[model samples]
Structure formats: C-alpha cells, structure tokens
Target: MDEVQVVVAHSERATLRVGDVFLKVDADQARIDIEVEAMALAPVPTPEVLWRKPPVLAIAAVPGTTLGRLGGPSTGSPAAWAAAGAAIRKLHDAPLPRLSGRAGRDVDALAVELDAECEVLVASGLLPAELVTRNRQVAEAALRPWAPAFTHGDLQIAHVFVDGDEVTGVIDWSEAGRGDALYDLATFTLGHEEHLDDVLAGYGSDADVDPEVIHAWWSLRSLLAVRWLTEHGFDPFLPGCEVDVLRSRM
Candidate 1:
C-alpha cells in the first residue's frame, strides 16, 4: 500500500501525495480551471496531468527535488538556479492565458491588502510597527502598472523542481495566470536574495525590469504571508524564516 503524504493543507485547498501521484483537492473550480489551462500554455516543464474529477485533480509527480526551501539555503547549483530562471523567462514569454483568476491583479488592490495586513501585524504586536511601516513604504514601488505576462502567481522556491542542473518541473499552478512579470521573479527569490544574480544571469538581458520593484515585492510578499502562515498553524516568525525576511529588509 502506498503511504499518503500530506504536501499541504489549508482552509482553501489541500494536496496529497501517494506513491508517484499527487492529488490536489480544491473547493474552487475556477482555480482548477486556471491551473489546467496555464499548465497547458506554459512553455516550460510542469507536472503531467493524469486526470481531473471536479474537486480533485491527479498529476504524475515529477522526479526531482525542489530547488530550495523558504527558510533554508538552496542546495541547487548556480546553474540549476539559472535553469529555473530560464524556465521562468520562457513561461513569462509565452502567450498570456485567458483566465479571470489572479490575472491582471490590481496594484492598488495589492497595496490595500498590504496596508490592511500591516495593520494586523502591528495591532497583534507580532511585529514592530516601525518594521511593518518601512516594508510597507518599500512595497510602494511595486504598486504600479506592469505589462501582463504568464506569471506563476506564487513562484516560491519550493515550487520549482530540478535534477542536477536541469529544471525538471514546476508545481503548484493554482495561482498561475497573466500578471506582473517581476512578481514571479520576486516570488522565486524571496528570502533567497543571494541567488538573484545567478537567476538574473540565466534570465538574460531581454527584460527591462526595475531592481527596486523586485525588492519591493520581497517585502510585500513576506508581510502578506506572515499573517496567513501564522493563522494556518505554520510559524513564519521562526528564525531565518518569513518574519526574519521582513526584519532583514529593515
């Protein structure tokens, strides 16, 4: 019998692994539609879709370790990071998928959410008001218009998989859609800024991206995730973790 591994479980969705297959269960049918569509449109490697049955989608596991973890050092070589970068570049360069989910997310709306979350962080006394304020100000740089691309809306380090120097697959596509290109880059390197250079090197010089915007996203994402992580029974405040990321920006 294959052991069932709980990859992730939250109020909104859950992912389970059994043997070589992954079962993603989501209550939102729209999100599943977007994931299936985005995976088909992506030019880079994504997990093979085995089947879909309404609330559950089954996919064959890609044979490779994740590129890195959120609060830890990446064991991936610079080349692997570069390959992942190249893969992102390919995805960003592809035609934008027509999806109502998270595509064309409003920057003003993001700023509003950031502000609300920062208030929660401060009122809870979980983080210093000064730290939250500074990051919030830094996040202002990302609150501008951007040319939409096929962004992996949540491109965390753990979502990218690699074998040796080759990127085998990218997972967790529920947030995939047309959005800001820099958002993807920032999400990929959040808390792992040290590897940004190698990733950018592989991404090449075609993109005219602003470095400040990328930095802003780091602050914004950390601030937003910290509260949700805490609520979901994951401690983002641990040392060398999401809270640490917010502090590092100070």
Candidate 2:
C-alpha cells in the first residue's frame, strides 16, 4: 500500500498524494469545472486527469520537480528557468479561454481591493505603515491597462515543473484564465528577483514586458496576500517571503 502524503490542506481545499496520483479535494464544483476546462484548453502541458468523483479529482503527477518554493532556493539552472519562461510565453500566446481567470479581475476593482487590504494591514499592525505605503505606491504601476492574455493567474514558482532545461508541465489550473501576461511573470519571479533576467531572456524580447510593472505586481501581490495567508495559517513573513519582498522595495 502506498503511503498517503498531504500536499496542502486548508479550509477551502486540500491535495493529497498517493504514489503517482494526486487527489485534489475542493468544495466548490465551479472551481473544479474551471480547472478541468482550463487544462483542456491550455496549450502547455498539464497534469493528466485520472478520475473525478465530485469533490475528489484525481490526476496523474507530471514528470519533473518544480522550479522552487517562495522562501526556498531554486535548484533549477538558468536554462531550466528559461525553459519555464518559454512555456509561459506559449500559454500566454494561445487563444483566450472563455472563463475569466483569477488575474482577470477588473483593474478598478483590484485597486479598490488592494487599498482595503493595505488599510487592514496597517490598522491591525500586521505590517508597518511605511512598508505598506511604500509597496502600495510601487503597486500602482501595475494598475494601469494591459492587453489580456491567457494567464496561469497564480504562477507560483512551485507550480512550474522542469526536467533538465525542458518544461515538463505546469500544475494548478484553478486560477488559469485570460489576464495580464505580466502578472503571471511577476508571480513566477516574485521573491526570486535574481532570476528575472534569465526568465525574461526566454520570454523573448518581443514579449514587451515592463520590469517596473513587474516590480509593482510584486508589491501588490505581497500586500494583498498577507491577510489571507495569515487567516489560512500561512506565514508570509518568512525570510525571502512576502514581507521580505515588500521590504526590498523600500
């Protein structure tokens, strides 16, 4: 019998690993629907669906290890990171999906939400006012208009898998949809600023990505994430994590 391994668990969803299969248990069927549909439409490689039983959706694990975690060092070489960037570029250039992705939220709406979160962070003393304010100012650069692209939405470093400079697959399609391509880039490179050049090199010069905008997104994402992460029992304050990312901007 294969030992069950807990991948991640929280109030909303949980993922468990048993041998080569991963079981994702999510309460919201709509999210599950989105994940299934997104994977089918994505041009990039995704996990193979093994089975689906309501809240429990089983998928075959993709080959290769992830790029890295937020607060951890990445073992992938520059070529591997570049390969992941190329994969992302392919996904962004693909035809848009019907569903709006997590990154597809309206700019005005996102700004309002960001402001509210910032206030909460300050009032609750969760973060220093100067830190929140500085990052908020920096985050403003990302609020401007951008053409929509098929985005991974939550393109965390851990979501991209590579095998020796070749992208094997990308996982977690729940937030995949049409949105700003830079958001995905920023999310992937967040807290790993040293690798930004390598990633961009593979993303291509034709990508028209703005480094300042990507930096803004780093601040915006970190500020907005702190509260939710705390509520969910996640520590965003870990060294080289969200708080560190914010501080670096100052």
Candidate 3:
C-alpha cells in the first residue's frame, strides 16, 4: 500500500501505503470508525479525514485528487461559522436523548465520568479540592434536557471548516459520545455570544434543546477542560476562559 499522502493526518494510526494492499503503522491503532461514526450529523466525502459529520460515510477513494479533510480546528472563518451554525440547526432536529451519567452507563451518562475525573485530578494534587467541587457543581447544572443529534465530541472552531457561508467539514471525533447536544454546541458557541445566539436562533422553535441547558453545559465544558489541563500540569490562571466560566456558573 502506498502511503496516504496529505498535508496533515487526523489520527495517530494514520499510515502511508507502501505497496499494493499493505497497511503500515507509523503510530497507534486507529479506532476512527466507531469513534467518529457513532453520531453523524452531515455528509462526508470519501476517504474522509473528518468524520465528526458522520452518517454519511466517506470510504477510500480510487485516488486522483485530494480527498482528505478540508476544514480545520483553528482556521474556520466567520462565514464558516455561519455555515456550521446552519448545519447544526439541521442536525439538532434528530431525536437524540439526554445524558444520565453518575445515574447510569447507557451511552448518555456523563455525571459519573465527570465526577470521577474531577476527583482524580484532586487526589493527584493537580487541582484544588475546591475546584473539583466547583467542577461537580457545574457538571450537575449542565445535566439537563437538551435534544441529541450527531455531535462532535469536542466541537470547536478548530473542528469546523467554512468558506463564506458554507460548512466545508467537521473534523475530530475522538471525544465523540452520547449526551445532551449542547455538550458539544456550547464549546464552540458560548465563547462567542453573538455567534452562539445565532446558532441558537438558527434552530428556530422546532429544536428540542433547552437554552439554559446549553449555557450550563458551556460552564461544565470549561470546567472539564480546565480540570484536564490542570491534571496535565497546566496553570489555573485568573481571567482565563476556564476560570471565567467556573466563576460565573459555579
């Protein structure tokens, strides 16, 4: 198999084709299919580098022009954001369920996982016990009614691609999981209030997701990321996005 040539590789397990029908490992194994296709939201091109928009599987191409991912996590422009917002509205119309974590492990539970994560951070001396407590509160608050859809586990500007008012692609699906849709939505929308509102408004009156739940999830999302960063030896600086979220919500 010849190596799959591209400017970037989304998964660590990504390999290049060396000969006819040969698979080589430059890194770890890729569990990409289950990870990204579990909850699809949009159409994806074949030989896809981005699967965050699953349900529209993109299989290997016959080879000709570039067929990998096009959007990026950091480079999506405002029009791209707008395009993404439109797509999100359409996706949210799906009949997804609410999370019941700490409640049970049935694909929608997030409470126990969040609690355990924060506790581990505290026990490891990475985060203050107070912060852990704050994280828990935020988590609890975020656990509310919001419709499910094909979600991007860690949806953000970095995962979106836009060209004018069109959404080119949705990248990254490693963290993809089932739960309230806003769990992903808030990560990208809340940070930019106006855009966030635009996204919400785009959903119109038909969407089942609750506004407060989205905000709560935004708070919880920040705490979760902060806790992870702290556990990984990052500083908990004041005025930081994480801190601001926790302080305001918790």
Overall lDDT per candidate, in order of appearance: 0.89, 0.92, 0.51
lDDT of 3 at 64: 29
- Candidate 2 local distance difference test against the native: 0.92
Pitting candidate 2 against candidate 3, the one with the higher TM-score is: 2
The pairs that clash in candidate 1 are: none
TM-scores, in order shown? 0.96, 0.98, 0.60
Ranking by lDDT: 2, 1, 3
lDDT of 3 by residue, 1-250 (tens): 3555532233343433333221323332233554334334344321343222222323322222111121212334444555566666555444442322211123335666676777776787755678668656656757654444555566765455444555555554545445456666677664554466556554455655566767777766765676655555544444535665566554
Full ranking by TM-score: 2, 1, 3
Q: Candidate 3, which segments miss by more than 4 Å at Cα?
A: 1-30, 35-41, 44-80, 94-109, 144-147, 175-178, 230-241
Q: Write the per-residue lDDT of candidate 1 for residues 1-250, one digit (tens) a residue.
A: 9999999999989999999999999999888988998788789899899999999999999978987788886788999999988999989988888865564888788888888999999999988999999999888999999889989999999999999999899988889877988999999998888999889988888787788999999889889998789889898977667888888888
Q: Which residue pairs collide in model 2, if any?
A: none
